[model samples]
Target: MLSTSHTVRRATSALLALSTSLLALALSAPASAEVIVRGTEGAPLHEARPAPGAIFPDEHIVVAQPSPSEVDPSFLGPVLLMKSAHIDLEKGTMTVPLRKGRLESGELVWSVLTDVTDENLANLHGINYSAKLAYGLIGKATRSARIEKDGTFVFASGKVDFKPEHAVTPGDAPNFFPPKSAQPGAIGDADYSPLVQFENGKNAVFNMPMVAFDASEETLNAMCDGAVDKTVVHDKVTAICPRDGTVTLQMTLGYTFGKPIFYLSTEANDPVVATLEGAILTPALNDTPFALEDAAPGESAERIYVFVNGPTGIDHPFRQGVNSALSDGGHGPLNVLGGIPTINLDYSPIWRLFPVLWTEEAIEKGWRTKLTNAIDIENAGAKGIVVSIAGGPPQAVGFLVNCPVVYRIN
Candidate 1:
């Protein structure tokens, strides 16, 4: 939910002042007069004199009045009324009701400035003469799992500490294309755009964190050789010698947008060759083609391409292609240079997962395993071999790997 720590206090003070001013104006104003309220776009969104007992939704109305100096001299002493209350138009004032059901959406500006000159009346017609209000929603979720389960995992016994490296809240997805009748402000859809008619609600995107694990140096070395055994107990003895004789680890898949993605992190300087299934994954973009056939013996392969946040010298083929496509035939300012439209790409700091082949020995093993669908050799080598998974971001999911078991070597 949106934080209201300061909004509550601030709105309270403003409402009290507004009520007092409104009461004073009502006592001095004419008996009746037509009053209208306009939005920032100059559209007539509200009018005075709601039916008796009519209740307005809370948090939707904004009340404000222009200062006497701001108003034209010919329209001075005009009676500005909203609902059953009057407003002192002489002061630069604004308010939002703390209570519910007093005014409807866009009705806070439903005011009357009595005895207005015909010439000065045109000055009060535009949206600049009123207050603007906006409305929207936000949602979020989080979950985690270990490598030993197939579905969502419950944190039952172990003491686990989860740390997020990036901001989890999806930033505001502003509608750059607002209604033409409204100001070209950030929020809502364009007046004539078809997206406004769409029923599905909008969503904010967020970058979730990936789980980390630790491993022993011997186990890491064994993994580097392209062959290792999966251990049930996950102890030091199992790291050095696999009694299970299988190069697979039981992982708990957490909640994800699609399939689970994985990545391997070694010591900062000690780079390890990594491959997903049979394809080489590179962290940065270059002339290097991501093909398994091109990998040399003992060479590390990277299946996923990494792009740093903000503008950088790093070249990302995927991001570039998307940018090019938008520039070629996209709508709004995004079609022009330096104006990229809002697109939720599968890009974030969290590293994706893929079955990594650390050593050429592992590739040479030619294990026809269904886990990765990678079989250089006709015969399958290991039983119960499980391949790594990949998933997209802006999803609400958590990953809990045996950190000590996966990163102990590092």
Candidate 2:
């Protein structure tokens, strides 16, 4: 069973404002914590681990588990605990148990795992770690919800309309920067965010992905054998089995500091957000109201990395092939999602898109190389080596996404 409504979005802005604090708190994961490191600095990671599949022998990192005294178990992601949940790194799939909860108004909200308090929590939950989320503490970056004793999630704000027809049209080759046009499959309201903060006296936020809303358990259980209803669930969902209580999501291959990773692209604040991420365009996000074009500072927003001159060709080892020079008719450059496992200490589903273009002089003088981390990008920029579109500084294009890191490809 599936349900969606554009009207629900029209009335969500004001309602979302009432719960900003809770949502903000939900996305906040303190940065002062140790991280899990594997393998030597430039060597392959050890093969013995809990996660499934053998990835390329490279660096692999996850967050350390948080202390029990600092967080409530209820606030942590529960997918890893389910016997049925499994992650197949070779096939690039994460199948987790679904959670059945309801809204205060009795609307059903079927959610799944992937969100955690921090990397430690991520490690415990067997999900990906995103350092970017630790800084998503301000603005309307997340939604507020309270889990009642009766399994009801009393939401303060944020609703989605899965009814809108989703579409992504790639531009002609050589200029795929701005897609022809795009429409997010599921449109979220002003306060719609995947980061769920339980206001039930828990000081933690979980990056929970709500797979279905106002859906019946019996109908959802049909997915165990039947086809998944894309109209009812998130677009990234590939398979869902309510009977077994597991949902599988399709992962996009990407790079972070030269390491391969797999992530889920679900909701975005703008059409450009959807275009760059190959995600859905959500118009209602305009109401969330955050600083655009690089004004977001401190706990305001996280970064979405774009390579100015990465290796080109789909078969390239680095696989980022997003250089403007290679104007092939490719649909995506597969830009990097900043602040993953061993990278930085910030992660958020909501991201601000900024294009990094290498200066002609830098390219001419053979100063170009695979730039890793913001410092590398910034240093090159300072030396007049790189600039975004129009020979100017790369600016945030008023876009954001609710993408959660799921798996790493070593």
Candidate 3:
């Protein structure tokens, strides 16, 4: 008979293998039944006439031309009138051009049916005609115009002088992390530091100074009325509440099989709290001595903590999959992080922590209250969770605020 530990290891391995196989099958499923081409306006366009010798086996080509108004001129440099277009479905080729003048009256906007997968269609959605015209110019003028999987040219502009200043390349998208081989189920390991321990429904108090937020009358008023402005400055939101009152917020964290559970509450008369939606937070090791303020006593409000992240925003594939799986009983897309090669498992339990920031609309309108008793962590598995907090006091009087907290559970 196998030892208990050995049996657990075997079971974990089998489970991971089964999960991987299921994921592969789901990814390999066939595309949608029909192919359609619609412009940004949601209207169907005319189909493209294939070239006499164009080759497409068991596939067709779909095409559409969006009006110049539909395109964002800031990203595509100068705007030009679309003149002509052609697409070869079998060859996986698209050719379009934009002349320096206006399109003639009664010009036909064409569309075609193609066998492209839905994933490719999603990436191609809202694609500007000017960008397509730029790609055509690059293909004709440069030797480095390699077409990407989504039918757009990569960053290799070659000798093409038409590269736009704000052109978006494939690198702009979120980079996924590779999946790791699941290890055997074991008790607490030395890899993760213990942050909180819960026993008999009580948590071991771990007191840390809370990150401060600037307290202002504007912030307080915004909070009271349920409005918090999301004005971004330097990729950060800077709104502070006056510290004229006292408030305390607590987040209860628990874990089972390497997943997280969160319960949030506050002691203020008017409770204002924020918790991440569709993400989890883990402690960042090697950071300075950091602790969340367990209690806040009203005093002078000058400094406030702000949340910061990348300008283009961050994407956590595992968290996204969890969110989708909770809504529907199926795993979503497989986001293979960095190509198909060596998988890194070092960043599995840690994420950069930040405060919840508000948007302009939220600041203008009174803040909305969002309270929850528990978070579903069944689908989190062993991947790192990146939590995104929402539902904080509005912009004016920002006194006691509640935000998401991270903890490590064995």
Provide the RMSD of all predictions against the true structure, rounded to 1 decimal: 30.0, 15.5, 30.7
Candidate 1: misplaced stretches above 4 Å?
A: 1-203, 208-345, 358-410
- Of candidate 1, the 10-residue stretch with the lowest lDDT total is 332-341
Candidate 2 Cα misplacement greater than 4 A, ranges: 1-85, 116-139, 275-297, 308-312, 316-332, 360-373
**Tens-place lDDT digits, model 3, residues 231-298:** 21000112222332221122232222222222121111011111111111112112212122212221
User: Each model's TM-score, in the order given?
Assistant: 0.13, 0.67, 0.18
Worst 10 residues of 2 by lDDT: 74-83
Error of 3 at 395 (Å): 40
Candidate 2 vs. true structure, TM-score? 0.67
- Whole-model Cα lDDT per candidate? 0.19, 0.56, 0.21
Better of 1 and 3 by TM-score: 3
Error at 41, model 3, angstroms: 43
Candidate 2 residue-wise lDDT at 191 = 64
Which candidate gets the maximum TM-score versus the true structure? 2
lDDT of 3 at 368: 17
Measure candidate 1: CA RMSD. 30.0
User: Model 2, 263-296: lDDT tens per residue?
Assistant: 6777676665664454545554344444442233
